[model samples]
Each structure stands twice: as C-alpha cells, then as structure tokens.
Target: MCTACLIENVKSHMLSRRSLFSGAAATAAMGVAAGALSARPVLAQAKGRVVDLTHAYDSDFPTFDGKPGILYEVDKNFDPDGYHLFKLTIFEHTGTHIDAPLHFAEGGTSVDALPVENLIAPLCIVDISARAAEDPNAVVEPADIEAWVSANGEIPAGACVAMNSGWTARIGNPAWRNLPDGTLAFPGFSKAATDLLAQTGAASIGVDTLSLDPGNSPDFAVHYSWLPSGRFGIEGLANLEQLPASGATIFIGAPKHRGGTGGPARILAMH
Candidate 1:
C-alpha cells in the first residue's frame, strides 16, 4: 500500500473510534435515569478520574441568614474521657449540601427519601462565570443552557445540572453570600433554566452559592418550581471548576436522616 493511503486509513480508523466513544459516553451518561445501575453503568465514568465537589465547613461557613451554620460543644476531652468527642449542632442546608424536594414542596420527598438512582447520575456543568463575575446576582439562564447544548450535545436525563458561576473563588469574601449592604448576592439557577432542565428530565441542580435561586431572588422561583417536581438541589458546592461540562458521573452522599429537608453532603464526580 502507498504510504499516503496507509496514513489516510489510520486517520479514518481513529476518527471512527472517537465517534463511537462519544456516542457510548452519551448513552451511559443517563444510564441511571433508565434504571440501569449495573456494574457496567458503574464503570461509565471515563478516565477513572474523580474530583471532590464538597467544601469543608465549620461554624464560620457562610449562610443565607448571616448566622453560623454549625456550632460545636466539647462533650468529651481526651485529657478526661480518654478520647475527645465534640457534640455538634448543625443546621440542614449548610455547607456543601443537598436540598431535598421538601425544602420547598410540602409533603415532598425528604432528604432520606430521594431515589438512589437520582443521587448518582450524569453530571452536567453549565458555566456562567463571566457573567457572575460582573453581576453577583447572575444566574444560569435558559440562554446559557442553550449554548451549552449547542457546544456539548444534549443534557442527559437524570443528570445533575450544576451552575459553575465561579462563586467558589469567593468562599471567604462577604460577597459570596451577601452584598456590602447586607443584601444576599450570589449566582444561581434561573427559573427558565431549571424549566429547561425539568423538561429534559434532569434529576437535580446545583450551585456554588448558598441557594438554588440567585441571591436577590424575591420568590425563590427556581426552588419552588424545581423541587415540587420531585427533583433536588445542591448548594454551597465547591471545586466545580475542577470538573468538565459533560461526561462525568456525580455521586451525592446525601444525608440519611428521615424527614430531613437536607444536610451537608459529600459529593464527588468521576470522569
């Protein structure tokens, strides 16, 4: 065979493999949504790379009400009790946490009642960082979702559509959860965007801020609509910058307390 022909054949074979991989990736991305949670689906995460999306929190972590999210009391000291154990007082919805449907919907699914399949599924990151940088109250609008789909293909069903507004960079700053004048200010999911997500059968939404709605939101529109539909939300997520827009699987280590709205979660994404 001619050298040129050989080179062309190799290139064609590589392209074919690339296309096949992309198609299969999209299929497995929504595997859990179809109730396919076998070992094959478990291995759907590509490259075997994992990223921790949870942020460590303490009493000082930012909150929506400007109050500490947790308090600690030393119940036992090593000097006296042979081992130290601190009795902790923690508030649901603090730190990197999941917000169950009950957070907004009456008689909705509680944190412990969320489906296991929904807790582990495709991870889709929609970035609005540039806009969030300029407007603290920026949100993941429908337009943003459209653009993401245009570039990265469709959002898979049962996916966790996370808004990466670059707010993770402001973790310790006053502007992270509030403006200078004591008003809340942070980026979140706009109602229109969540509407699109719901239409696509998305299981959950996430934000790097304290709430699912933008800080200045008057009605919590996204929360009211999205949660009542039986979907969940995650807030105060960190390290979203380390993940990609698609092809990652999220595992939400949700709180198991019965009747709880939600609590701090340890979330991880494997790509």
Candidate 2:
C-alpha cells in the first residue's frame, strides 16, 4: 500500500478502538446509575421515625395557676404591609421547661451553662401509671428503680430516666390543679430514687407530670437531690405511653435564654 493509504488505515483502526472503549465506559456508567436508582426504595423504606411524645402549651392548656401567664398576641400593625406576627411573653419556666441545676442550687449551672452533650441521651422510661392512678400522690421509690432495671437490663449512665405517671390524662380536666386540700398532688420520684439516679450518673431526670416530686409535699426532696447534683430536669412532658421502657434516645432542646434557671424545651425520642 502507498504511505498515505497506510497512514489513513492506521487512523481508522485507532478510531474504531476508541469507539469500542467509549461504548464500554458508557455501559459501566449506566450500570452504576441503575444500581443507585435501585437502592432508592430501600433507603426510603428504612426511614422509619415517629414522635414518641407531644408537648402541651397554650392558654387553655392547664398549668400551675399562680405561676406567670403564658401570653401571646398578634402584632397586627407592627410588620410592613400589615403582615401580622405573633408576640409571646412569659416566664422561662412556663410550660414543658427544663429545670437546670441552678433552679435550686445557689452556684450551680443554669440553662445556658448546661453542657451541650447532656441535652440528648438514652431514655429509661419507667411505667407506674397504674400505681399513680390508684394513689394520686404516688412516688416512685428506689425499689421501683431496681425492679425496672431488673426487667430491662441496667439503667445506663448519662441517660434520662423518665417516670410515667399517667398524670397527663388529667391535664385538661377541672381537677387538673391542686387536689381538694389546696395543695397539688400527683406522682413523682421519691428521695431515695432521686438520690440513687444522681449517684448513678444519670444525665437528667424527666417526668410526664408537673413536678419531679409529688405535688402536695412542700419539701421538694426529689428536685432538691437531682438539681443540686447538677443534672437537668425535664417536666411537663406528654405521651409517655408511646415509648418503650428502655431503648429510646431522647433529644432535648431548651431555648437559649440568658441567665435563665429554666426554659421551655422541645423534647423528642427516637428508638
């Protein structure tokens, strides 16, 4: 063959090889794209999440009467073009709030001072709803804690132990406030239970009720024991019946109010 013809033939062969390799590359790319598309349904189906609790907050929602009022009003004319915006004013410890260490301790940590890691932790939910229903002033004692641990492994350190007293059912009723004697009476932890949890390195204590101690008692021994230990408190929580006894991870977020001893928080749980 002539020199020019030979060079043209070589060029044609190189082009054909390049085309073949390009086709193989495109095929591999399509396979990867198909694999990714196939995994989409699996990822979508695996996303199983639910709310284990709900928080109650409103004027009609019953709270301690003598405490500050939770007020909110529309700022009708304030925004440009008359775009109405709501304004809220209330005490930090208004509804579903966290009681930081400083709530009772003189020099202890406040809401702003609490460690970030302590806000979220494992939850050990104790169910005493039946007992609480029998006696309005029921208190969870150390033996109860031991019983719970025996049934569901150990109560891990750095976990929030929530006492479920079924008191949330009475929240909207006329008898939601203090009992007949004029003193609030509900369910909570006893001194022994509180101290045991504090010593065991519980990150915080939570309850689906108004107080960490039985309402009728003037002495808040449970609160006194837990708060002074620098652990946090989660009160006024609702829907404790939805969670399992010992497998949920709780997430707690309090509003960043400066120098606040306590502040309203949004608490959620995940299994």
Candidate 3:
C-alpha cells in the first residue's frame, strides 16, 4: 500500500479501536450498576513488542539552564482516601516531550491543535553515533540524510525522523546537560538537514538530546527552519538504539494542554 493510504488506514483503525474500548467500558459500568456484571475479558490484548521511547520523569531528570526538575507529593494515601494519589509539579517541557509548532513559530498550532495523524507515522532513525562520539557537538547534516536514503530508500512522507546520536546514553548524568565550561554540548540537526527533512514532507523530527538544535546554538536555526512549516519536534527520547533504521511505527501521545507550546509525551514504537 502507499504511505498515505497506510497512514489513513492506521488512523482509522486507531479510532475504531478507541471507540470499541470506550463502548466496552461503558457497558461494563452499566452492567455493574444493573447487577449483571460478569468476569470476562472485553478487549483483546495487542500483539507485538511495544518499545517505550520516553524517558522517565523524576527529580533526577536533567533540565535546561539550571532549571528545577519535577516535584512529586502524595495528595492522598490509601490510609485516608482508599486510593493513592499524587500531585506532580512539572514544567510543560519536562522529560521526554513534544514541541508543537507554536513552540518556536509565531501563531503556530498548539499542542491541543496538533493532528493525531501527524503523531502516528513511520519511524526513520538516522545514526550519526560514531562521529558524535568523536565530537560531542556533531550535527546531522544534509549529507547524512542522503546517506540514509541511499541505504534505506526514500524516507516516507509523513514519517518521523529520529536522529540517533547515541546521546541517550548520557541521560541522568551531568554530561546530559552542561559541560565543564557551562557550555552545553550535544548532537542535533543542522539547518541544512532540517531543511531537507522539511522538504521531504516529514511530519515530525526527534532527537535523543535535550533539543533539536545543538546545545550551544546561539540561534535555533533548525527549529526555525522546521516549525514554521507546521512540523513538530520530540526531544529527550530514549531507546533509539532498540529501533530499526526503518519499518517501526511511532506513536506520540502528548498531553493536550490548551495553547501549550510543548508538553510531556509518552512515545512508543511498535516494530
């Protein structure tokens, strides 16, 4: 099937399955109220191994520019409330997150406005790890994309391209954020590469680092080059090494915060 047709089918399947679940939940609730509840599984378990692409959020997670990380407090405990509930204080951009177009572009789509179709697409991993190991500030260039295309065929339209610089290995360590001289160093996309991906009709771009642009970038050229075209970004991704160069399907489940420029997301990849 064509990429567009496959994407549409996936969307339709997702929506229909969601509706099925919702209906099942409602029926179960009604059954309990009417004393007709039975012990039977209502939904079939999904097949395949699902890989988590998100980083776990906690006080230890790295933040930008010395900013404070997540804070959690028990709002209610089983002793008093018959349930455990916690209150979380976190920034919208904390942990593994998605940056809507509005994150960098003026009057762009907010997190709530981002289409679900855009969040589900073919995943393409462009590995530049060896070069990144030698130079911490290595940026993915247009040549890298060309090399990827040469080996993996064309990057499908509406695909999410993830740059695997092997940076996730530094997560939770001080090296993930700042350097000795206080200059952040990490691999990210160059303006030329961002332009090439945008031209290819990519739905989104992602990186294992904290930002889509290099940590030391004075001007966020990559963000400017892509976000203005209504594309989104995913940052602080984990387990890129587990995904194949192609064929995996990524689903980004970002919080729908009204007018939010960005928000935490639970990204998953199904191979």
Per TM-score, the best of the predicted structures is 1
For model 3, residues 9-109, the per-residue Cα lDDT tens digits are 99999999999999999999998856532211111122366899998878778877567667889999999799999898888787899888998889999
Residue runs of model 1 more than 4 Å from their true location after superposition = 1-45
What's the TM-score of each model vs. the native? 0.85, 0.78, 0.81
Question: Which order, best to worst by lDDT?
Answer: 1, 3, 2
- Scored by lDDT, model 3 comes in at 0.86
Which pairs of residues collide in candidate 3? Answer: none
Which candidate leads the pack in lDDT?
1
Question: 1 or 2, which is superior by lDDT?
Answer: 1
TM-score ranking, best first:
1, 3, 2
Per-residue lDDT value at 43 in model 3? 10
Looking at candidate 3, what is the lDDT of residue 28?
91
Q: Which candidate would rank higher by lDDT, 2 or 3?
A: 3
- Which of 1 and 3 is ahead in lDDT? 1
| lDDT scores of the candidates, listed in order | 0.89, 0.78, 0.86
Model 2 agreement with the true structure over 1-271: per-residue lDDT tens digits: 9999999999999999999999999999999989767544223222245554656677665565555447888777544646767788876665688998889999988899888767767778888899988888888889889999899877777879999998777777645556766677778888889888877778998887777888776888877778988888888888878777877777788767778899888887776
